[model samples]
Target chain A: MILRPQLQDIKIIGQYSGRVILGLGLLMLIPLLVAVCLGEHAAALDFVIAASFCLSAGYVLILICFTHKEPTWKHGMVIVSLSWLLAMFFGAVPLYLSRHWGGYLDACFDAMSGFATTGLTLVQDLDHLSFAHNMWRHLTMYIGGQGIMIVAITFLVRGAGSALPVYVGEARDEKVLPNVVQTARFIWLVSLVYLLVGTLALSVTAFSSGVPAVKSFFHGLWVAMAAWDTGGFAPQSQNILYYHNFTFELITISLMLLGSLNFRLHYALWAGKRKEIFRNIETVSFFISIMLLFGLTAFGLASAGSYPGVSSLFRKGFYQVISAHTGTGYMTIHPLQFVGEWRALSLMGVILCMAMGAGACSTAGGIKILRIGVIFRALLEDIKRTMLPRSAVVMDKIHHIKDIVLGEKLLRQVALITLAYIFLYLLGTLAGIALGYPLKLALFESVSAGANVGLSCGITRPSMPAALKITYIFQMWAGRLEFVSVFALLGTIIALVRGK
Target chain B: MIGKNFVKIWLVFLGISTEIMMTVFIMLCALGISWLISGGWR
Candidate 1:
């Protein structure tokens, strides 16, 4: 029987969601302070108005939906799905008020992209955008990378049952610590530590590369946040290319790699389990996949005579492949270079990397290394089973933080998620092709959007059809959540409408 | 708290170092293979 949510269930969900929105309002203060300090009065006013609206709306929801009952697991998941949509709506207030976006829909698109850490932007005149607005853009990446519910869980939510469902709903299945709140705190601890070290290293590099000291530090911190979070929004339109320093590129690359690592792996390593890095299935799979893709991309570039020399191939080709593989879209090359210069084979290599993506429970988006590792192991298990005697037993295991036996259930779940990601990628590609983009370019952009890798090939602009924009937005949202939460949301809506 | 987590701090450093080293090693191998396939020393 299809169970429909009651009004009380909806109220409980709203109550919890209000608390998260209120937390988001508090987060907006960081950019507001930046604006006030920089004397961007107009931008400061926009943030002020937006923050006030968020706080007021959140308060109103909490007041209206006040409930003494604890949220059920279903309520937690529904709240998380609805909270993200609410966050996108409320988060876009300042961007819309700035009048830099084409319309309210475009503002919402960038907001979702930012919160998803997808990095595909629709902002117009990003270069001239005020410091406050720019800070908010990168701040969304930091907030989103940690999972907005994580912030609420760390500071606001107290109940373990409520916290676990929202955490899982955010596409993070592994808990680094026994307590969900402690796991959320540990995630923040790791990110904060990296934020400090990465920003300092990149700041020095930027300053040494002749940028003014203050601008260097600001840009350094912004880029580092984007990189380490695997959120590719750049303060400037030119992205990593604007720096033009090899040192900067290397630092960002290191950060991206760190960002793509599973948080559970991070915990195990931090606990002095140094051998875990080598033994983990995801790490081994990532290493092999990256190397394989890198070779293909380099060969394609060489055969096409696209890059003139070995240095260009290493700098442009290898860097881009790694970025896409990590689901970090900080591109040193221009968007036109992908469409005009990169060969079909090279583009396909990048598309594949983006589709495969980084580790599960990490900031990156796509099918994830964990699933890929599981699928590969499942295939090996099947092969062994076929070769062995009928009475003989075959067992497959993968070491994450610990050894986990590969079972039918695990294989089925991994395959299902992988299929969903492929379907989402194809949906966006068809939409792009229908809008008159070439098949290759359409496929590239669609994969980029669907994988939450922001490497564009000159197709995503303000001039594109609104339908395509909305389709890509849907793709980004569904891809980031890995389809389960989105499907749950759809199921709830259908039950409400069609249930007897 | 930071001072108490000294071992963890050290391991975090080691972890990052290992990642960088692995990345460099793989990139070099990829470059060498690509160079050979594209007709090396031309």
Candidate 2:
């Protein structure tokens, strides 16, 4: 018996949900083949289970919930948010059930790390991992960065209204093109271009560093995805320091900024809007924050004598600054250095940078700078109104896509949400501190997790207390979707419990 | 017409990003040059 969900409720799951899940399942097939090729019986078996689960799950969902109704904006958010949650949940299976990893929590942590493009890992010895496994890990970041939903939209059978929420939930709601599918297409193309250029450069650097061709090729692909997504997963057990070359660091830095940028800027460029580079407020803020934070951090680190010379001073400080600011989470230096010395001032700069996060639609996660800009513009409006007489009235406004959006109510809503972000941060930190971790370490871990920055001061380990792990997981979820979608989920739950 | 506008805007933005890319290129060259002058990596 087919139970037709209400048309409204069906669209709430997003358009073509089954096809998208099938695609995710199909993506697993390649890794399954690779595992089979390597003759890793256990790994192949794991993929077989995962793929079957995804296929059947996708098939059932499609068969049961086939609806002609189009997705509205509200449905788009619900479906996209929940779809990611579902994908992450099912996606964790291969890692979770394998004989290699013991705990379910750790497996989910690893899978969420991959999907969220957060580089935090709980794996003890990455050296023992098979090549096929590492490649699968890299592929997860690649798919997650561009978004599997956006891929669904780009090839969507019904194109009219399907692109809006897919684009919006994929985090690129700002219309660079009139059609959202075109915007999504343009994003893929730009990413491909960067991937080609970035991989070649990184490959050359790695090869010159005496890394083998096979190692260079695989590592190059891994770094490209990680850096391009503002993700910090390193191919080596030691992360980026495995190469330990300044040139390698420089290459990764450039890629992180490129990945952190909104695709609209790229689209605008492809269309010959040279001024869009300067006109982009998010890009401007990203650079300004990097510079200001880098300057202060380098000075403080140098004064503290963390490194010997000025070049090395700029080198270490700038990389860490970008890693944190972009939420890429790669670290070349010991966290102990950042932790023990320059605690108050350095951490302040670092924390503020992580909170600012990356471009709106880009893979880098957190509250996002565009929303922050909206909040800032709102504050300025308040200040101006304070100085003006009672009779005077003001309109709040913000700039985007070469136009102004004027609405005080919208601005107030954004500001309120930003305040909510701060509260979430403090709450996570307190939870960790209350559980018996050092105060500073707890605060750092909370911000890192909450911002999805993925850089641990070495505090989060396999041995970390269970209560702390739970805290970090919630932070990662809240940070990745931003607080709005989580709040929306909470509201839905509340409504069901209270009313229905 | 919208597609045309989108193309024009993208190309113009691309041109500016080219300059930004060039700045990065030049800076990278400087790093290599100074490294060479300083007798290469330690």
Candidate 3:
């Protein structure tokens, strides 16, 4: 039996949640600055109103729930989960005010998608959207990728013990540093460094591809944020295809891979542990899975005779496979190409890649390569145990930043999370099919949303069913939190409803 | 001191370069396999 949450529990959760919302309010200032610089006074005013509202709401929560008590683990988890929902509502304020969405629900969906780092969009006339709104959309991904709670922990939240639970609640279990604050700073450092490098690379490629210098810089920065965060919102509806350059695609591919690496691995690499890149189980698993999926997709495309030559196959076929696998959702081809042109087998291949996703503790979502690696290693260990004599002892180990023994507890955790991901994928798929979409397209879009992958096979549109939109939003939220925090939030709700 | 700083910078550059090369290498391996399966060499 669970005890009902006390008022103090609510206060603790509210205080932390308010702090995170305050951090988000601070983040909204980025787009406001962008609007001011671009001389979009109307858009700047929209941001001003939204920011003020967010700040005011956050302050009210903090003031009302003011507490001297530190947040417990349950409180941290509750805070993280509630903060995401609140962030979505508050984040949508500016988007809704922009009048680009059909309703507040649509704005909330896009805001959730952005904050979850899932690239699905419900905004109307995305091509005609304001620079400030577009910046906010992509900026949400960058913030969400590092985690909104992490920003709070880095700046506002004191007490290392209190910060750790919130940090872990955001689906980042790996502590890159001993202290949570230092880890948060390092995460930001890695992202900022990559942002500068990726922006420059993309800007040069964009300028060479005929975009004006100023526009190219902005586009490059936006695309860099989107790709590096694996958030699929592109400034233009055409996405990567808008630039029409292979060089630009190549740069984005690099950014996506780099972004999907675990922060611990990034720390290791930065510390000059070059061999760690090769020896890390997640890296090896990703390399193997990507290659196999690439082959599967290539064969499917070739069998269908979709692309005439190897060049087109690499450009069209390979790029989408990698993008899907990385959960970046930077599509060069039109969404219709997946449904009308690509065969079922290739579609399945892309779906499988999207479901597998990138490294653990990274921005990208899905089952994660680390869990995949652990599962495979566990299987091998089982096989070895069966073959070995009764007296023989088998100890399975995998290298991350350090060597970790693969115990049953670890395997159980991996299996549980992987199963939960598949269930989430199926839930979305069933919802899609119930809404009259075909099984293949339903599965593709479901896995895309559930995996936080932005790839759409022509199903996600402004005119799509509102039920499906809400379903994908839930999937993105649950997927990004990896079900743990979501379940915690659900438990809290249950306790409130039925607990004595 | 200048030489030491230069060496440090060079090491960081080398580390970054190796990582990039590894990324490209993996991408190429995938592309090459795809090419082979597509019968492009033939």
Candidate 4:
């Protein structure tokens, strides 16, 4: 029997959701300041209106749903899912006001894409986009990559006990520190340090590429945010290719791989647990899988004679493999070249890498290396047990931060999540195929959206069917949240409508 | 005190450098394998 949610539950969820919204409203001021400093008065005004609307709505919600009680797990889950949807709407305000999108829906799609760190874009005249709006777009990736709930917990929310559910709801379950707040701060610390380092490296590379000093700095900062978050937005429409510098591509690829690593692993490494890098299952799996996939892609492209020599193949083909594997989607090749030039085998290799993404509890989405590693170990253990005598026992353990036993419960959970991702990929593919896309392109785009890897096959544009855009949006949101929070939201809605 | 802080900073840098080195090595390996498969040696 389902119990209906009480008024108190609603109040708790609403109050926390309002706090998240208020925090988002405050974030807009950063870009607003950027616009003012750049003397983009028209763009500044758009942010002003959008910020005011967010502030007022947030304030009103807090007042209407005032509560002193801390959020329970249910309240936290509901708040996270609800706040993400609201964040998409509010975040889209300035984007819509910029008059670059075809409609509010297009803005919303881009907003959701940014927040989910999915990197798909639907804006027009992207090259001519204002500096402030571009700042906001990349900022969305930074915020979403760190988990929006984390920002609120670090800055706004007071109670640590209440922060855990929302933190877990954002698909960040591993706590690097003992306390949730401490973990949030630690996550921020790691990101900030990397941000400083990554931005400087990219900026120098860009400057060497002959971009002007000021443009190089901003471009470096924006790309650092996108790369560090594994959110593949670039300042210019050409993405990393605009610089045409191998050094820049190398720096971004390094950052993308760094971003895809588990934050806990970063903590361990920073704390001088260097051996963990070698012993860790995720890193080992990532190395093996990337090498295997790159081999496939390289052979496929080689057979097709897509590139003339090994140098071009390594430069273009290897970059795409790593980009896809890390879910960064920073394309050197144009989007159309994916379908028009690349053969099916190469596309399949990229798709597999996107599906088997890097690191659990990291910014990169998909089934995650941790789950894949565990499942593989579990299969080996089973095989060993079968080959041995009936009385023999096989025990398998894998190292993350520490050695974790391969248990049936863990395997079941891993299998379920992997299946959910496959289902999502299939769902988005069906949507695309229904709209007259070819099977290969549909599957590629579907996995791209569902895995939050923003690689496109020329199908994502302003003119894509409205339904397809919405489907991809849902896919990005659900994929980023790892289905737990979205399912919790759905269960809540069902309880509201049909509960006894 | 400055020396201690320097060591700490150096350790952090070293940690990041190690990760980057590992990434570069893996990428080089992948590149090398691809080179072999694509008959780059030929």
Task: Identify the candidate with maximal lDDT.
Answer: 4
Sorting all predicted structures by lDDT, with the top scorer first, yields 4, 3, 1, 2
Model 1 lDDT per residue over A1-500, tens place: 78777889888888988997888888889899999998999999999999999998899999999988887667767878888889999999999999999999999999999999889899999989998898899998888889989988989887777788889889888889998988999999989988998999999999998999988888989999999989899988899999888888888888898899999888877777878878999999998898888888888888899875767777798789878998889999999999888998899899999999998989999999889988888888888889899999766898889999887898888989999999999999999889899999999999999999999999999988999999998998888888888888888888898876
Please state what fraction of the native interface contacts candidate 4 reproduces.
0.52
RMSD, every candidate, angstroms: 1.8, 4.9, 1.5, 1.2
DockQ of candidate model 2: 0.21
What value does the lDDT take at residue A460 in candidate 1?
90
**Segments in model 2 whose C-alpha atoms lie over 4 Å from true places:** A1-18, A36-41, A377-399, B1-42
Query: Against the unseen true structure, what C-alpha lDDT does each candidate score?
Result: 0.88, 0.72, 0.89, 0.90
TM-score of 2: 0.87
Predictions' DockQ, in order: 0.45, 0.21, 0.59, 0.63
Pairs of residues at least 3 apart in sequence or in different chains that clash in candidate 4: none
- Residue A91 of model 4 has an lDDT of 97
TM-score of each predicted structure versus truth: 0.97, 0.87, 0.97, 0.98
User: Which segments of candidate 3 are over 4 A away from where they belong?
Assistant: B1-11
For model 1, state the Cα shift of residue B16 in Å: 4.1
Alpha-carbon error at A438 in model 1, in Å?
1.1
Q: What is the per-residue lDDT of model 2 for residues A304-342, given as tens digits with 9 covering 90 to 100?
A: 666546467546666777788788888887667667765
What class would a CAPRI assessor give candidate 1's docking?
acceptable
On the 0 to 100 scale, the lDDT of residue A246 in model 1 is 84
Q: What's the DockQ of model 4?
A: 0.63
**How much RMSD separates candidate 3 from the native structure?**
1.5
